[model samples]
Structures are given as C-alpha cells and as structure tokens.
Target chain A: MTNIKKLISKPLFLPIFCMILVMAVNIIFDAINGNFALNFFTISVRNGILYGRLIDVLNRGSEIAILAIGMTLVVSCSAGTDISVGSVMSLAASFCCMLLAGFGVSSTSSYNVPLFVGVIAGILLAGVCGAFNGALVAFLNVQPMVATLILFSAARAIGLLLCNNLIVYVRVDSFGVFGGHLGILPTPIIIAAVCILVATVLLKKTALGLYVQSVGINRKASRIAGVRSERIIFICYIICGLCAGIAGIIASSRITSADSNNIGLNFELDAILAVALGGNSLGGGKFRLAGSIIGAYTIQAITTTLYALGVSTEQAPVYKAIIVIIIVAIQAPPVKAFFARRQAKKAALKGGVA
Target chain B: MKSLKKINGNTLLLLITIALFVVMYIAGCVVYSTKGFTHLQTFLNILINNAGLLCVTCGMTCVMLTGGIDISVGSLIAMDCMFIAVGIEKWNMNPILLMVLVLVIGAVFGMVQGFCVGYLKIQPFIVTMAGMFFGRGMTAVICTEQVSVSSSELFVKIAQTKIELPFGAYTNNKGVLQVPYVRIPVVIALVVLIIVFLMLKYTKFGRSLYAVGGSEQSAVMMGLDVAKTKLKAYVLSSVLCSIGGICFCLNTMSGSVQQATGLEMDAISSAVIGGTLLTGGVGNVIGSFFGVLINGTISTLVKTNGKLLSSWSNIAVAALLCFFIILQSVFAKIKEKSK
Candidate 1:
C-alpha cells in the first residue's frame, strides 16, 4: 500500500497523470460538442492494424521519442545536454532530400537512389558530425554545451550548402511512403518502438549503461575503475547524432519536403524537457527508459491537445511554454518543500482532530 | 622572455583577438578596395551598426565570467523593444520614461532569475530557458505583428539623427580632407564599455565576480558573498540587455516579435571570439568589444561581396569561434605544462 502511494506520488506520476487528464478533458469535450474532438480510446483493427488518437499520438511522437532516447544516452554518458540535435536533424533531413533528388533542383522526373541508401548515407553523415562534436568534448576537453553550439550554428549552414540553399522537392512515391501507413498504423511509431527496444536492451540489459552512469556520476572514478570514459562519451554523442538523423528522415518523409529552417526546430529543448519529465536527473546518473517513453507520450498529448484546442499552430509554443514552466516549477525544490510542509500540516491537524 | 612567460592566458587571448582583427581588416582592405571599404567611415560603421551587439556581448561576458549563461537575452531584447514601441506609439509615454521603466523591468526580470539560480539553487540554463519562454511568449501576447516606431515623431527624430563623423567627409573645393565620425549609439556603447571595464577592473564587486567564478568554495572561504555577486552579475547582464534592446530600437527604429532572434548566440560567439572563455573566470569586457567588431566586419565583407550567401557569415563566425576555443585550450594546456 505504501509502495502504491509512493508510486502515485513520484515525480514521474504528474506528467503521466497530466497526459491522461488532458486526454480525458478532450474526450469529455468531444462528447459535449463536435468541436475540439479527439477520441481517447477508440482503437479498432483497420486493415489489420491499430487505429486511434492514442496511436496517432504515438506515431507523431516517434520523432521526439527517438531524439529523447539518444538524448538519454548522451546525458547519461556525459552529464551534458546537446542543443545541436535540432540543427543536426536538419542537416540529416537535407541529406535525405538531396540524395533522393539526385539531379538538379528543377524536375521530379530525375532518377534517384533507393530509400535505404539515403537513410544509410544520412545517418553516416550525421554520425560523423556527431563524432566531430564528441571529439571536441571528449578529446579536446571542451564543455559539451559550448562544443555542441558549434554544430548548432554550423549544421544549418552545412545543410544549406548541401542543397545549394534551395528547397529540394523529392517526389519519390516510396520516399513519401516512408512515413505512410503501415497496415493501419503509422510507420514512425513502429520504427520508434524498435529503436526504443534496442536502446533499452543496450542500456538496461548491458554493461554499457552501467559504465555510462558511473562516468556520468564521476568521470575520474569511472576512469579509475578501468572505464574508457572519453570513448564512452564520444560513442554516446555519435549515437545521438545517428538518432537525430533517423528522426530527420522520419520528419522529412512525413512532410514530403525538407525545410531546413523548420525541421527539428527546438526539439533539443523538448527532448531535454521529456528527460526531465521522466524524472531523470539532468545532472546525469541513473535513468529509466520507461519513464522517458511516458514523458514523450505526454509531450505529444500536450501538443495534440493544444492543436485540438484551436490554438494557432505557430503560437503553440506560447501555450507550451506556459505548460512547461508550470511542470518544471512544480518540480522545483522549493515548491516540493512547500508541498511537503503542507502535507505534514494536514496530517498533524487530522491527528489532533482524531 | 620572463615577461612574455608572465603574460596571463586572457591577455594572450586578447592579443590573439587583436591580431585577428588586424589580419581580417587587412584582408578586407585588400580584397574589397573598390567599394571604399578602406575608409575610416567604414571602420566606424562597424561600431555603429553593432552597437546593440556590443552591449549584449558585454552582458554575456559578465554572466559567463560568473559561470552562468542567460540565453534569454535575445528574447528579452525582443520583449524590450516591443514594450518600448507600444509604450511610445500607443500609450504616448515619454521616451525617456519608457527607457528607464524598461531598464528597471529588465533588471527585475534578471533579479528574479538570479535569485532562482543563486538563492534557490536552480540550474542557470533551465531558469533562463524558462525566462526565454516567458520573454518571448509575452512579446507575442503583446502583439504578434511588427510594431513600427516611424509613426512617433520623437522616435523618428532620435533614430534618424546621426552624429556625423568627419570620416565620411570628401575633399571639397578647398581640397581639405576631413576625418570621419560615428553616431549616437556608438558613443553610448563606448561609454558603457569604459564603465564596464572600470567596474570589472577596480571594484571589489567585480573582482569578487571573478573569484566566485574561479572557484565558489574558495570565494566563500575568502568571505565573498557568492550568491550576491552572482545575482549582481545577472542583474547587470539583463540591465545591459535592456539597454542593448534600446540601442537595437535606435538602429532599426522598429520592434517586432521576431526582432533579434538567435542574437544571444551572436553575443556569446562574439565574446568567445574576443577571447572570453565560456567556462568562466577567464575573460574581459574589452575583448568582447573587439569580438563584436570581428563579427560585424565579417558581415560587412559578406555584404560587400554581392555573390556570397548571407549564411556564409555564420560559417565564418563558427570557424573563428572554433579556432579560438582550440587556441584557448592550447594556451591553458601550455600554461599547465609550464607549471
């Protein structure tokens, strides 16, 4: 019973609770009126696959979800957040689009390469970029934030140089099909799920996660313990870069075009927030993949709810900022202290009354 | 040789920065002499155009010296400019009063963030990210569209007026070559730079800032109010950002929701380019002044070359930043080796 209560009172509980509560509100609103309608639990088999807003949220969330996975690893490895993910994702998106485009920027009739080839090329490039950033931090001993800021500023410039600063429209029937429906569900959700599964096994089921956590906790101690801490940190950044590349491919395919300025904008912040919402320490150490996954769902739910609430898409950030501030503030130490004091007072008053 | 060895890392960095400026300008003078790029007016133009950037870079330098960062300064500038525009255009508030009020508001904003970061022990990035959101969101809430100041006679008068330099002067009928000059914003920026230099150099508060940044435990042992020093640093940063916002207004003579987007990065980059270490305890304000100038000159060169993409400027800036970081790291390593 105490354990159940503790689970309910855990820092991770609020975000999950908030997600469900928001969905319930939207459901109730749907029932009352036709406007702002979002089906919370109308899952049914269609064409031998799942169909529902829950699935939609999962599908739409796969981009941030994948980024969050990479972010979790990087944070665990180095105790530093990478803000360059958004821009790196753009660079990947540009690569995918440009590879698919093949010829000059003029026509759709131009023969292009296969999807897997583009995917492989894009992820490799992104990984190289990530390794550059990692080399700066790991080998050169630069702080991760400042080191990543280089790529954050340069990634888009490189992306522009890739496509010659022109919007390349690739209309491969299979290119757009990358994000299309698989059976009845979204392809992104499946890819994201697979990625998460692999990540979980790599972290929770292997010794790498332990090394990462120890390094994050104390690099000197980890090094003393025979861990190649720099190599671990470097590999972690490379993983993040590859994951960002995957997210970019998913996004560009879904939209059918690569817009360098808009792809993965502010995603680093969202991924970091998701990690926080998962109750993982930003200072880095122990982390839970399950909690971070739930946090990703919560983010998707919030964004979907805002869209359904009729907020202009561009201005969604305003409402998101409010929600994020509230969520983060509530988790603040001072606020938690205040809550603990109130809870204690309530218990004391009840005891006196009894 | 002993004196050379005695030179500190920051001084070495400052020397490198000066050398870079000299090399860059000489190159600029060589390549683009056709457009009168070698003139004294062109040089002052860098200071005038980047006056706002100078202020914000100085602000970033201060916060970094205290081992903190305010990523929201860019957004805060947007909010500040918008508030001023609305105050002057819609409410008809006196320009001077609006400026003072905006400065106070900015200072209070910084104070709250500082208190959270210092007294409450919140991470500076998270606190300031929230601050960014609030500042940016508030601007949108104010009005999503552009707020022009050209309608206000006083604003137009202030913005349009240029304190002409003799550098732009041509030889008249008397064949006298006159020296060129600068505008009001440049003048204000120079004054602010001097004041900041003095504060960081002579004041106990300034030295305490460095002490706190170098090692908080030692600073505390040395009887410095670590929290207060940090708080003051933030307050000074935001106050300067507000003043920079005003200068941006004077430069563009308009305010919008999207004004100064990603400007905080430029300020930080300029400071880094100027030789201020991002890790804190190892920078000076004067270096940051030269840093902004370098960035401005790059942009100026790009403008002069009609064929190049403007995004190329960011590439150049990033390259310079990476170079300096590598240099600073090497310098630190060499110093450690000598020891």
Candidate 2:
C-alpha cells in the first residue's frame, strides 16, 4: 500500500494519468459505436509493418516528440519558450530540399548534392540560427520571445527566397527512406525513439541537467556556484535548433518536398503544448523527459481520435481548444489548491466524528 | 538642463524610434527621388494602407504595457471578418448591427481570457493560444468558403468613401488632376490612436496598468487591484482589435479563414519596435503608430522598386526589428551602469 501511494505521488504521475485519460476517451468512443472497447488498443500487421490507431499516434507524433526533448531543455534553462522552432523547421526543410534539387530548379529526379550532405547542411544552418538567437538571449539579455521573433518571421521568408519561391520536390526514392519504413517499422518512429533515448541518456549521465535546472531556478546563485549559466542556456538553444532540423528533415522527406509556406505551420505551439501537458511548469526548473514524450503522443492521440470520430480537419481546432482548456484548468494552481483544501476539510471532519 | 535629466528609459526609447523613422523616410525619399517618394501623398498612403494594423498595434501596445500578450488578435480578426461577411451576405443582417455584435463578442472573448489569466493565474500565452485556436476553428465552422461583401450596399459605400486631402494635388501625364486622399478607416485609426495616447497619459486605470506591469508585488503593495487592472487591459485590447477587424474587413471586402493570418505577429513586432518592452511597463501609442508606418513604408518601397520580390520587405522588417531590440538592450545596459 505504501509503495502504491509513493508511486501515485510521484511527480510524473499526473502526466501519465492525463495521457491514459486522453486515450481512454477513444475507448469510450469505440464502445459507444458498438465496437469493441479495446478497439483503439488493437494492433495488426500489414505489409510486414505494424498498423493500428496506437501506431498511427506514435508515427504521426514523431516530429513533436523529437521537438519536445529540446523544448524541455530550453524551457528549463531559459525560463522562456522559443517561438521560432516552427519557422526553423520550415527553413531547414527548405534548405535541405533546395540543395537536393539545385537552385532555380523546382523539381528533380536526381540529386544535385548527396542526400547526407544536404541533410547535414540543413541541420547546421538551423544550428547557426540557434546560435544567433542564443547570443541575443544569453549574452545580450534580450527576451527569448523577442529575440526569436526575428527568426519566426524571417526564416520562412528566407526559405522562400532559397527555394526561389517554389516548392522544391525531390522525387528520389532514397530521400523517402527517413519518412518511410525500415524493416516493418516507420523510420520516423525509430528516429524519434533514438533522439529521445540520446537526450535521456545525456541528461541522466551528466551534470548538465542539474546545471540547467539550477540556472532556471536561480541564475545568479548558479553563476556564483561556478556554473556558466549563459553557456548552458546557449547550448540548450543549439540543441533545440538541431532537434528542429531533424524533425524538419523527416517532415519534408515524408512529402518528398519542401512546401515552405505550410510545412510545420503552428508546430511550435504543439511543441510548447507538449511540454505543458507533460506537467512541467512553464515558469521553468525541474522536468522529466518521459512525461513530455507522453504528452506529445497524447496530442497525436487526440488528433487521431477526433479524426476517427469524423470531425473535419477545419473543425478539429475547436475541439482541441475545448480539451486543452479542460486539461489546463484542472492543472491550474487555484483548482489544485481548492481540491487540496476540500480534502483537508474532509479529513478533519472524519477525525472529529471518529 | 533640469528637463534633460528627466529623460528616462521609456522616453529615450521613444525618441530613438522617432529618429529611426525620420531617417528611414528621408533615405527612402533620397533613393527614390524620381519615383515621387517625396510626395506628401506617399506618406498618406502608408497611413492609408496600414490603418487596420495601426489599430491592432494600439491594442497590442496596451496589452504589452500590462505585461501580457494576445496572439488571438489575429485569429479574432478572422472570426470578426467572417461573422460580418456571413451576417450581411447569408443572414442579410444590417452592417452597423453586425459590427456591434462583433464588438460584443470581442468583449466576451476578452473577458473569458482575462478571467483565466488574471483570476486563475494561468499563463497569458497558453490562454491566448487556446483562444487563437478556438477563434480560428469557429471561423471555419461559420463558413469554410470565402464570402466577399460585394452585394452589401452599405459596406460597399463605406469602403469606397475617401476623404481627399486639400494639398498634395498634382497633374498627371494625361492632364488630369490627382488629389491625394485617405479612406474613412484611416480617420478612424488616427482617432483611436489619439484616444489611446490620451488615456495612457492621463487615466488612472492606465497608470495602474503600468504599475502592475512594472511589478505585480509592488502594485499589490500600492493597494492597486492587479487582477482587475489586467482584466480591464485585456478587455480594452480585444475591443480595439475588433474595431481593427472592421477596418481590415473594409479593406479586404471579403471574409475567409485565412483573413488576417499572422497579423498578431505584426502587431506585436510593431509594439516592440515602437518602444514597448515585452517585459512590460514602458510604451507610447504615438511610438507604435510610427512603428506601423515604418513597416508600411518598407513594403511600399519594395513595391515601388518593381524589381525586388515582395519577400524582401519581410526580411527588411525582421532586420529592423533586430536592430531596434539591440539598440534597446544597449540603452538598458547604459542606464544600469549609470544607476
């Protein structure tokens, strides 16, 4: 009983509960339609690959899951959200496609540059963009939103200029591998898993996570304790940029083209929402990777559920807003405090009666 | 000398913005001397083009002054436009009545968001983001197809009505007179700007907004109602944004889900460039007006060049935003050192 109590009291408990709660809605939805209650949980093999609603959620959620790892760190270190990740994703995808299909050439069946070279260049450019934002925020002390606002508007435009105001399509089969399948498993799922694993290991194996939390909690105190707080913040943003680049590649590779205008539109919002849904405070400090990953998948689950229920794409945001409000209100401090106070009152009354 | 010493950080940033606008305008005139950039009509055209942006930026300035943000403004504008367009076209409602309904909706929307942020202590970004989603989704629900207000007699008349300037009249190559003029929206926007300027300068509620933004704890200690102030600020912002939406609808004469998309960023950037701090507490409506003008002029310059792509204007605005932010930071550092 004590062990169960401790598990229930864990910091990660709320996010896991929320995730399960969201997925449970699908179960209810299925049962109401006279389908099996476990319909949402069923997984089957098709064409030597796993396929199911659950699998779809995992597969579709790869980009946000990958972006969440970096977002968690950035929020922890800087106590501010990066609003440029969506634009950076679009920019990186544009650069990769532009290189693959040479400048002034909108469509190509052959590569102008090696696939790996283009991918690396895209990620590196994203890193450079990150560095610029970091310099402004970490050294020059500009607000994170204000500093990143520069890229949020400019990156997509630069992407447009690079693509010569056209969507660059690389119809090459090899370019599709990242967004396609490898040995019956979607490559995007594998990529997201690897990124999450690497981030988890890096955070667990080093003192970097501690330093980031310390800086987030109290920058002056951390600096006094010999931590390079500014450097830590800069590194976080660079990692975030790199993550966006990888996600961008996967995104573009799925379509086998870079549509700069629409790719990753409003994705930064999703990434931030993932972090919030993970039960991490937006004000910064301690965090958990598992929770954020779950949050990302939960978001995808919500979308998949809505689609299965026949909601049109245009109307999905309204339902999404309603769900988000309910969830956020539940986690609100006042609501929590109210519940806690009620519980205390109940306990006191029971003791008096006994 | 005594008055010079009183030039604090807020006033200093405002002065810097004014000077930058002046320099950029002069440079534009010199570079495009043959293109009539120096003509008074060109300046009026900037104001005419960005009237909706001007009103929206004023609302953004108010929210920023209270240390909050409203990204839903863009989405709300879309909703307002769709409501007006559909109400008049499909529902066959009165234009003036439809506008009043939009303002009421804006108030209720703002009230809900303000209650969440102020009373529940939720993050403004998250609340407003949800609001953004809700507004946009509702717009799509209202009408998935674009509805142009072509058949509405009153709307068309209001849109076509132009107030011509007495000066800046010139003769064209065809021996016809070309008199510079602005539409009714420009007049409305300017009136709003003046009203906001005065309110921010003299009203008690406005002073409380600055106090709460400067520091919440201090504001509470000063016996000011921080939550109420925040709530009122949001209400003011949304009301202004709805008014701006009317202006935007007048300009476009159509309603679509994509209408005024990404406009929130424009308003926020304008407020920031106009010397409003994101951290809150220092801003001027007059400065924000010039910020809108600066953005307008950049696009105008790109248009007049005729050779450059329109995307260049976006890049130019981003660069200008970067410059102004850096300048503000340096000025802040200097002030800290002096203190």
Candidate 3:
C-alpha cells in the first residue's frame, strides 16, 4: 500500500493522469452525442473517431516523444534547452531528399537502393549539426538559447538553400514501410516505444545517467566528484540530433515529400512542451521517459478531441496554449506545496481520529 | 581611460562589424557596376528604408541587456500597423494621435509582460513567448487581412517627401542624394540612443539593471528593487518597439498581420551582432545601430546583385549572428580567465 501510494505521488504520475482525464472527458462527450454505447461489460464507439484517431495520435506523437527523450538527457546535463532541434530535423530531411533525388529515383520508385543510404547520411548530417550546437554551449560557454538559436535559423536556411526552396517527393517502399503500421501498430509508434525503452534503461541503469543528474542538480558538486560535464553535454546533443533525424524521416514519409520550410516547423516547441508537461524540470535533475510519452499522447489527444468537436485548426494552437499554461501553473512549486500541505493536515486529522 | 578600456572591447567588435559592412557594400558596388545597374539614389533609399529595423533592433539590445527577450515586438509592430491603419484610414485621426496611441499600446503590452516576469517571478522566455502569441493573435483578430492606408495626408506627405543631398553621382539620373525626412526615424532612434546611453552610464536604475542581470541574488542583497528595475526596462523596450512599428507603418503606408513576421529575429540578430551578451549584463545601443546597418546593407547588396534571392539577407544575418555569438563566447572566456 505504501509503495502504491508513493508511486501515485511520483512526478511521472501527473502526465498519465492528464492523459486519462482527457480520454475520459472525450468519451463522456462522445456518449452524450450518442457516439458511444456500453452493452453488458462491452464498450463500443465510432471507429473513425476513437480507434482511427488514436492511430493518428500515435503517428504524430512518435517524433516529439523520441525527441523529448533525448531532450530529457540534454536538460539533465545542465546544458539548458536546445531550441534548434526542429531546424536540425529539417536539415536532415532536406539532405535525405537531395540524396535520393540525386540517385535518379523518381517519386514513385518501388525499390530504391539510395533510400537507406539517405537515412544514414541524414542522421550523420543531423549529428554534425548537434555537435556544432553542443560545442558552442559546452566548450565556448555560450548560453544554450543563443547558441541553438543561431543554429536554428542557419540550419533551416541551409536546408532550404540545398533544396532550392522546393518540396521534393521520394517514393521508396521501404521508407514508407518504416512509417507504416503492422497489425494496427504504426511503425513510428513502435520506434518511439523502442526509443523510450532504451532511454529508460540507460537512464535508470547507467552511470552516465547518474552523472548527468548530478550535473543538473549541481554542476560544481558534480565536477568536484570527477564527472566530465562537457562530454556529457556533447553526447546528449548527439543523441538529440539522432532522434531529430528519425523524426524527420517519419514526418517526411507521412507527407511523401520533404518541404524545406514546413517540415518539422515548430517541432522543437512541441518537444519542449512535451518535456515540460511530463514533469521534467526545466531546471533539470532526474529524467522521465514514460512521462514524456504520456505527455505527447495527451497533447495529441487534446487536439483530436477539439477537432472532433468541430474546432477550427487555427483555434487549436490557442487551446493548446491555454492547456500548457494550466499544466505549468499546476506544476509550479507553490501550487504543489499548497496541495501537499493540505494533504498533510488531512492525514494528521485522520490519525488523531483513529 | 579605465572606462575606455572597459568599452574598448565592445568598440573593437563594432569597428569590425562596420568594416565588414563596408566590405560587403564595396562588393555590392563592384557587382552593380559590372552589371551596369548601380544607382547612388537607390542605395541611399535602401538605407533610409531600413531605418525602422534599426529602431527595433535598438529596443531589442536594451531588453537583451536586462537579461530578457521580447519576441512579441514583431507582433506588436503588426498590432501597431493595424491600429495606425485603422486610426488613419478608418477613423481619420491625426497622424500624431496615431503615434501616441501606438506608444501607449506598446507600453501597456510591455507592462503586462513586465508584471508577469518581474512581479510574478515568471520566466522571461515563457512570459515573452505568451506575449508573442497573444499579440499576434490579437493583431489577426483586429484585422482579418491587410489594411492599407490611402488618404492620410500627413503620413503620405511624410513618406513621399524627400530631402535630397548632393553626394556621389554615377549618372545624371542617379544624381548623388540623401533623404533627410525619410530618415527621420533614424534621427529619432539616435536621440533615444543618446538618452539611453546616458541613463545606462549615470542613473542608479541603469546600474541596477546590470547588477540584477549579472546576479539577481546579489542585486537583491544590495537593496536594489530588481523587480521594478526589470519592469521598467521591459516597458521601455516595448515603447521603443512601438515607435519602430509606427515608423515602419508610416514608411510603408500599409498594415498587415504578416508584416514583421521575423522582425524579432532580425532585432535579436542585430543585438547579438552588436556585441550584446546573450546571458545579459553587457551591451551598447550604438553598436546595435551599426548591427542594424550591416543587416540593412546585406539586403541592399542582395537587391543590387539582382540574381540572388532576397532571402540571402536571412542567410547573411544568420551568419553574422553565429559569428558574433562565437566572438562573444571567446570574450566571455577571456573575462572569466582574467577573473
């Protein structure tokens, strides 16, 4: 009972709660509108609205979820946030498109040798961009915001320049299959799950993860304890870059075209929002992969619910912004402390009665 | 001499930026002369046209110095443009009244952000980010589409009137000239710079901004009203942003929500290129002016080339932003080593 209570009070619990709450509210709304039915221990809903949309949520959630996992590591290293992940993703996508196109494969090729090659090349390019960002923040001692902001603008421009500001389409069956699903499980969702699993194990079972948490808690103390803070930051960025590259592939594959300008636009914002909403402190310490996954799903579910309720696409950002504000407000220390104190008083009264 | 030495590093950075500007301009001149499309009048016009960005960048530098940022400035400019268009075109208000309205609106927007950030202890980035969304959304809500001002006699006169000065002439058609009235905003920006420079150097509040930015805990311990100081800084930045916005609207005689979409980035890049540290506590308004000039010159150079995409401006600005940030990092390291 104590272990269960402790688990419920954990920071990771909030994102899951948020997701479940949103899902419940959505189902209640659906039921009122006669879209859901419950018949003797069985439940049914409109297939398009619930199950089909869940697939969409999973597909879209994958990129941000993966990026947030890597971002968790970067933030845990006390290197601050990277706002250039979106730009890096775009650069990778553009590079892949350019490579595939250079190989003379039309937009409708069934088998293309260059497709896998392009993915590898794109990942490498993204890694290099990440290294550049990490170098500035770790070695040059520039603020993470400014260093990444430079790369954010420059990388996107470089991508657009490389692609001549054109959207390039590539048709590769293997690439499409990577983004497609098997038995109602989207490939991106599977990829995200695998990435989360890896992150969870690495963070929970590895010395490097502990070192990163120490650095985040107190850089001076961590350094005194012989942790290589700079190297940790560098490695974290490399991982972030790799995740961003994978996200680019999924995003581009979904559209069947790589748009230099629009591909991965505002992705960094989404990833950061996911990380923040997942109860990962912007001030950084312990990492939370499950929380981030739940957070991403929550965001997607909210949008899906709003859209189903006939909300305009333009209005979605406004609602999402409000939700973000509320989540952050609740997560604020003062608010949490108020609730904690209330719970403590209630527990004391119950003990006295007993 | 001690102050000079302290200011010397920033000055050297400014000089290097100016040198780069000159080199780029010379290269543009060569390209234009070779293409037989160089025009002295056109070059002067470009400088005058870019004065509004110069004003906006000036405000950005001040805000950045205080360890804060305002991405909402671009959207504020959009709002200003809408209001100005509505005031002049719809209500037929006096042009000066429009300007005053813009300033007041900008100040209010800034104050709200300042209150959230300074008093509520909210993060500057999150507050400003919220402000950006709200301001842009408000602009769109106010004006469904572009609003063009047609019959503002005062604004049109200000924009159309040109005071030509004799200079270098490549041809009779391109007689050497300068437009004084068109560059009025630049002059206004210069006056603001002078006043701000004095305040930064002499006033307690100005000193407190540096202290707070350098170390908020230390500033609080030193009995400085860090909250008030920060609030005042942000409010001041917003007012300057408003002025720049109005000037921009006045220059174009039109207002659109999409106008100044990336203007915040332009202002930030200019501030960074001018030697403002991203971590705050150190910057110069004058250097920021040259930073804007460099950006302006790049666009002009691209325009002169005729073959290159105008987006080369963004590329050039990005390059400069990266270069100067690297430079700032090196300087910071030197300072740290000295300490």
User: Which model scores highest in TM-score?
Assistant: 2
Error of 3 at B89 (Å): 6.9
Ranking by DockQ: 2, 1, 3
Best model per DockQ = 2
lDDT of 3 by residue, B1-339 (tens): 887777656667777877887787677777677653355655556657766777787777777877887777887888899888988877989988889988999899899778766775656765665566566656766665788988877888876666556555344436743332335665566677787778778988778878887888898999999888889888988998998887788677888867887788888998887777778887777778777877887777777667776657778888888889888778777877888
True contacts kept of each: 0.32, 0.70, 0.21
- Model 1 preserves the real interface contacts to a fraction of 0.32
- The CAPRI quality class of candidate 2 comes to medium
In candidate 1, what are the lDDT values of residues B102-193, reduced to their tens digit? 99999998998898777766677777777776788788777788888866777777777777663467753468875676767787788888
Those runs of model 3 whose alpha carbons end farther than 4 Å from true positions after fitting are A1-9, A28-34, A37-51, A103-113, A172-174, A329-354, B1-8, B34-43, B82-102, B138-171, B174-188, B253-257
Residue B52 error for model 2, in Å?
0.9
Worst 10 contiguous positions by lDDT, candidate 2 chain A: A322-331
Q: Can you write out model 1's per-residue Cα lDDT over A183-210, one digit (the tens) per residue? A: 6768998899899989989987888888
All candidates: CA RMSD (Å): 3.0, 2.0, 4.4
TM-scores, chain A, per candidate: 0.89, 0.93, 0.86
Candidate 1 or 3, higher lDDT? 1
Q: Give residue A231's lDDT in candidate 2 (0 to 100).
A: 98
Q: lDDT of each model, Cα atoms only?
A: 0.83, 0.89, 0.76
TM-score of chain B of each: 0.94, 0.95, 0.89
DockQ of each: 0.45, 0.66, 0.38
Tell the DockQ for candidate 2: 0.66
